[model samples]
Target: MIREINFDGIVGPSHNYSGLSLGNLAATRNAGHVSRPRAAALQGIDKMRSNLALGLVQGLFVPQPRPAGEWLSDLGTTIEGADRHIAANAMSASSMWAANAATVSPSPDTADGKCHLTVANLKTMPHRSHEWPATLAQLRLAFAGDAFAVHGPVPPAFGDEGAANHMRLAPSHGEPGVEVFVFGVSGGPFPARQHVEASKAIARLHRLDPGRTIFAAQSEEAIAAGAFHNDVVAVANGPVLFAHEKAFADRDELVAQLSASLPHFELVEVPDAEVPLADAVKSYLFNAQLVTPPDGAMTLVAPTECRDTPSVASWIERHLASNGAIRQVNFVDVRQSMANGGGPACLRLRVQCDPADVDPRFLVDDAKLDRLAKVIGDRWPNEIASDEIQSQSLVGAVVQARAALLDALELSELG
Candidate 1:
């Protein structure tokens, strides 16, 4: 049977605060703060466990090679001798945000009746541009069978930010769905990362029905306010699409098109009056994982920041008081990721496929989580101060930590 499995990236030992992302407000604001890599990874593991308790299946991707010495060398310098900014970008643990890893099309939505995954080129940011090759290798390893097709990436000329800008709305996981591709043209101070041409290329490559697919424009206003990716301001699961009021350039037209296509589409749009755009982006209010557990009503897995922010918290309370599209709210502590400009939703890539078809090693059970935690607690660095990123000892530990994880999981080929 087809099921929705959320594959979350394990936070890397190199996870730090270099603020490599320009459009992400949270990252820029917290650029030089000391980071806790150990805590950050443990937090991610805990998130997967919590979701498991909610009766959701979970999968994981190991952090890619970091202190990317090879990438720096390709750029005509060594890690220790390169410009600090360039070196920092090479050491980035931003790979933890797996939502940008790929845009997945489930078999039900594809003409070939096979799940398809297209890894994002991510050409807009230098730190992220080198990620696709690693991400592609992982995807191929996990979904190597005929049940799935893993494509490399769109041309580098057209920037593709992956699943963060894509949403699928289906009546059920096994049924056909309408895919929405949200692209941005202007981000004011920041460059809009996902291009329309990239989205169209993915649609054609995925073999999706043109009539069922919708290409919507992301609002410039929201992007300028720091909602860099579409998922930052909107997300969809099953029959529901939860978004902030200022999410789209043409909200009315998008809603009409969706309603006309989907018989049970639920539009749970949070109004600007209740929670303004600034608060929405600040608290990552709309970046929640809207999931339908085994049998219960859909629930939202949000970051703790949502509860801390008064307006977002109040709006959530109001939504829960009545029977809304999302009935329960689960506030998880992923502050490490949040402070670096991501939240619960940002940490995962949703793939619709049978759990049996995926590489068993990537699928996590309680025992796997326990084993993973042991490796992390033992080898992951305790803290990563910006000034200390260049330390040889720190670099050695970061590399060793990743290798240790691969060894524990018996997937040493990745190392």
Candidate 2:
């Protein structure tokens, strides 16, 4: 049977607020505030448990090494004498948002009948660029079988943000689907992150049918308003597309193209009259994780922030009132991650494959999740403020904590 599995990134022990991300509001607003690393990991783990409870398949990805040595070495700087910019980028735990993990094209959509994955170079931001190598390692390990083909990131000239800039809409998780690749030009004040060329390169590399892929430009206004990644404005599950009115540069044209391509296309547009784009960005209304479970209607797994925003809350009430596909909503508290500019959807990467085909060590069960939580609670730091990021004590602590986590997860090889 076809299954949709969510592989969530475990918050690293070095979780801290340095505000390194440019277009994320939470990152800027919460900069320098003290962060609770232990709590952050537990919160993410709890989210995994929540999904598993709903009978969905869940997987886990351990955080990449903190105070990334590779970045410092590239700039010919030592950790002890690193400047503020270098230090901030080194300590970035942004990889916890696995939605940017990689762009995935499942078996049914590829010509060779093998699932394909291409790591995102993430060259737009210095902090995120360091993630590809480490992410590639994990992708190779978890998807090591005849059923998969995992490729490295494209050349750095074209900036790619992975699944964050791509969405797939199919009749079922296992069927051949239409892939939407969203790209942004650099007219906005905020640096446009995903490049159109990069999206085209990935689509070509995956050997996807040219007719099955659609290329659309992101709105420059949306980018300036902090919709750095397309996920901030739109999301897709099965054949349903939920987005804000200003999500794309030309929403009508894009929807028309999708309808023409797919057998049955469903679009749920939140108009500017009811909720403005600014409010959607602030509340992460579209960033909420939308999942279709077995034997029931689709459910929206949203962050608690959505409920707190007046306009967003009203939209949710109206959506439920219609008794549409999104019949239920589960609000989760991932404030620690949210403060770093990621919501529930940001923490996970969706892949369609059979559970039995995956590496046993990478797959998660309730017992394994509980053990992982205990490890984070017992070893991860209580707090890490921005000012203390470069301190020697915090450095040692970050290193030791990661080692402990690797050991606890029986992944010492990765450590």
Candidate 3:
């Protein structure tokens, strides 16, 4: 049986707003503010539960160890001896945004008919560059069942940011689909995170049909305005592609190509007049999670920030009233994550496959969620001040808190 499961990363105890992600407006604006790690994790959990209540399958990925020992050592210092900035970046729980987790090819789309996932290299940012090894370890353990095939990321130089740069479109979630890989060149003031070569290599590695795959470059304007990842400017759900007018450098050509391949698909574009590229970035309108359930109209799960933005919220209302596959809009409060440049969609990765093919330890049921909520509430810090990043006491607390979280989920092996 085919299913779409959302694997959300368990927010780490070290969650803080360091503004390390350069192209992220929210991160830059809230650079040194205090963060509520416990609230952040629970907010994510609440979003997961909401999806589950809507009859969606949900799963979890254990957080990677923070203040990564290996990274500190690479810098020729131990965690205790590292500078405050280094320590904060090392312990950043940015991995909680699983959209950058990996690029997945469902069974029906790959040549082998076995689900394939390649962990992202994330070489664009220094703090995130060290995440792949740890992410791969977790992917291996979670998808250990025979039905899955997991691969390590491409070499560091190509600069792959995984699924955030890739989107799948099909008549149905279970069918073989068209994969659109969005890459960008560095011509803007801000760095273009996803490289064209990396996207192509990943498509080849996944063995997707060349005829069904398309490569498109993100617009320089979007990248310069903080659309670092393609997901920040465009999102796809089944056959529907919701995007901004300037999302791609060659929008018309790309749309023509997509229409040729997926004739029946719909393209819902937000023109610059309705919401400028800068406004879109500021509101994260395109960062919303678009999902088509098994038997209902498509739904758009947007962050509360969208509703707060007059232009974005108005545009959404107007768009929904007009005509499109997206019938309903649900706003979720993920302010903590939004402050770090990730919205509702950034917190989870969507995998279309059978649930039984995954490790039960990674799946979520009401019982497991209850336990997770309890553990997060009990252990996660209520406040994490930026200045406290160097405190030995705070570091120790974060370490112990993660240990307790892993133990709660019976995932001590991740430690």
Candidate 4:
């Protein structure tokens, strides 16, 4: 009975929005589009969708606090109000509303049966000190247990260090049993020497994995060329590889190491597209989330542009119908003003579901729980035979066992 799970969404400041009209601001800053007014309107729609999705997922949607000042007054006020409104709606929808806290990027940690979150702080440009402590504190508290393990934002041996925007961690892959492997920057925009030091820190950490980890070094020049931005956006499973064409000069050696040590490893080649790497990555991640299968097969949903561009939709439709188990993948006509992109899974994070308890046929209605129980009983007749086990006795045992597990985990204190 996993009741609570934490997840982080990218939300914060945008310096590029400065001095622009709301429409122009969103177009230039958020969507990177030419139609300023349309983009602004779309931003509103995206925000609403983001809120609804977070609410549905029963997870916290943490955003940076509104910055003070007249210049950002209107935008800041709107975002603040939106956050409160969404949170209220979410609470009303679920009795299991856990907790929501504001912070910049959170530190990474793992604890048995609980997820920890760290929000990215965008207020203090390029500085780690402003929000790291608070982020770390929240993560520590959320994942307080003997099984907790600190994983990311690997600090340098000496001096202050900034956290990387992209890195690998488990749970992100939805693979519970695999060893966590980390990659990405150790420091910030720099003299390259700092990156070397950061790389060294990663190398030391890599040694901890023996043959189980792989580090793909993307050159400073490539990262500067907008590689890091795209990589971060595209990451669905693990760390974004920021590599130039030549960066894989040591590819064979790396592959050999990965094959020897890691349960899985592969170097992915990114396509050269007109869109910014970040945007491309966003689109990739968006699609990935849209069509995740229960059996873990990779599937792609119909493209959003399918209505106007049938050619693109047909390809995905054919693929899904012929190769994948997707029952259907229709292009949903969403309000253009939303802040969230992607369908279904992209918007709603799956918090908890018992494989033994979940009934695929379960419906959402007043009698949903009862229907689910009935379906489970039908599916596993032997496990619930009336002659062998009385219904009341089973219920009592389940309730007692749940209470005992909660007590052992000390979740009562959290309440």
Candidate 5:
């Protein structure tokens, strides 16, 4: 049976989560070079892309829209565009903080085959007494079938209490049982204590064991050596807290520890590189967005730049390849970008996938599986095709289904 999953939207003031809202600052800094609308649009597009990609796989996309009062005036068109795209894809979408909604808490009960929306009031600091009932009502109306839960009124200390950001849930499939890891906050310039507290609260609600969670610690050694970001990324792979390099000797040490302790868990680590923040942001968002179920495997798609970084790509490839549980390794081609920071995994997020769907044997049977393999290859262009045809299962059916769907999406988007 397909288990139901529930997720909360990280509602905040800025489009990007966990980082400073550079929208206004970027505008002032590049006033002559770029327009405010263009800048906002770029960020908005990234946000929309992240949300939609997750929605496509997860079967639900819930976002706290720009605050209720500001929705029509500031974000109505964007919301409408997102709605249209989601509907076009035969997916469900809803806003937690739409104009008529109440305070953004008290998530609703789950409903079958529908998406839920739970809003958070971004205007209030340490928003202690918001009405969760109304929010719950909305969610109940939407996602009634899935397991539903609520997290936070993040404490005042995590960055700006009023800003919005999301917490990611990582689920892994084990042969005998399933394992789950929930990460509440990630990305650069970490948030304050309250944010971490809020994440802890959410993790508890989801039944994640606190003992197993990893916390992000600050280390001057990492910063001095310029390995801070990569260090944090490795720690963020866990469910409880963010990891820092100061806490360990290096990335390998951290990975080794995680491997020893949580042998079933997937460890995602970023490399130390000089890349545009936008691309980095996208990579983080993509990872969070593409979580597989507790019993399934996932493939990380990042740009060629990540591949070139021996410390980053080599480590990731080695981990996935050696790990008995990992199903596949695929690379994304981000060569189109002038800056060239992202790859396949960076651009897409996996919300949901049945373990039954992924077939490693498909890689080995390139010749006989050509037709189906072509469809899978096109959808996932970064994966290296193997010559051996280990399994011919579902090759024909998957190819046909994917081709038809791709054609339809192309026609609809073009129209």
Candidate 6:
């Protein structure tokens, strides 16, 4: 029964383009543009449906409450009184990127034979720092069974950005795996969000074997080129590691180490000559979801932008034509998320576990997606302009919309 269930974060009604993420070029570039929350959420639901059609298990996380009223109160101000930057932080919906939710170690790789999840502190960004508590609440509920163990955020002194910076290479979902934790020492032009110390601490917390665990430094050049998190430049699934040429600080050494440590390991590296680093980051070619479907060849779930970018498109065609490790390429539209520096890979947190052990409410089906879409269409705002973030009317609408989703889901403790 053990399988990989991708838990995608539901796009919130407060989703906007305030450019809260510092190193993410897409978010910064589209800072003032209008956002379509309804469209965004629907798009996410459709993405989940697409995965389900591919015979992949799919789960969901409700959006964290916005206007983060309590967080704002601690800063000695309310949403209306806060400055534009602060106000935007208060209403940020960055939680939609579930990849940042937690670092998951499947039961097969853990010492106790139970899956472990450590919520990310996300201390680098003011808007994201307060997310752990809400994220922890959801994880606790979804994985309450004995087959799972959910840990709180690591100490704030060490920054941890979760699964977005972590990857596992294994023979299968139910087998012991080699886990890699990628951290940034210095982001160069951008701030290094994941600390090496934090990554090591998580390894201990999960009780992973020292021999099987790895701590890799993210490349400064890559981060400087807008590859903020390791996920932006690489992704791992099954025994394959798909990455850009400059993803790691020490690419050859890391590959040598991985090849020596893991069996049946395959590397699908895209040389910068084929697709330059700038274009790779812009098109999110490496951020694509690398998955092994239940009944099909290994697949790459990438964004439409990758298909549109000339260099990236050419590379993908060649990859497909060669019968590469990624046998199928499926393109999905998440422009709403893409504009904010998140792509298909960013939208999900992969958990390898038995479906029966997980809370059924978090799992979704086509019928359930239909219901969720109806709620989104009826309640989610059609558009969110930058200037309207502070309007009491919009705040009320956003708050009400979340409540409606919670009521419909029937398990929310009120995010």
| Stretches > 4 Å off in candidate 3 | none
Instruction: In model 2, state the lDDT of residue 71.
Output: 78
Residue 86 lDDT in candidate 3: 86
Between prediction 5 and prediction 6, the one with superior TM-score is 6
Cα TM-score of candidate 2: 0.98
Judged by lDDT relative to the true structure, which candidate is superior, 2 or 5?
A: 2
Residues 54-106, candidate 5: write the lDDT tens digits.
33222222222121223323434432343432211111011211211211111
Q: List the residue pairs that clash in candidate 6.
A: none
lDDT of each: 0.94, 0.89, 0.88, 0.29, 0.29, 0.94
Error of 6 at 346 (Å): 0.7
| lDDT of candidate 3 over 82-142, digit per residue (tens) | 8877887798998999989999989889998889899999998888999999899989998
lDDT of 2: 0.89
Query: Which of the predicted structures, 1 or 2, would earn the higher lDDT when compared with the native?
Result: 1
Every model's TM-score: 0.99, 0.98, 0.98, 0.43, 0.40, 0.99
Error of 4 at 304 (Å): 5.3
lDDT of 4 at 46: 41
Q: Write the per-residue lDDT of candidate 2 for residues 102-137, one digit (tens) a residue.
A: 999998899998889999999989989999999999
Error of 6 at 259 (Å): 0.8
RMSD of each: 0.7, 1.1, 1.1, 15.8, 14.6, 0.8
What's the lDDT of the predicted structure labeled candidate 6?
A: 0.94
Better of 1 and 3 by lDDT: 1
Better of 5 and 6 by lDDT: 6
| Candidate 5 global TM-score | 0.40
At residue 73, candidate 1 shows an lDDT of: 81
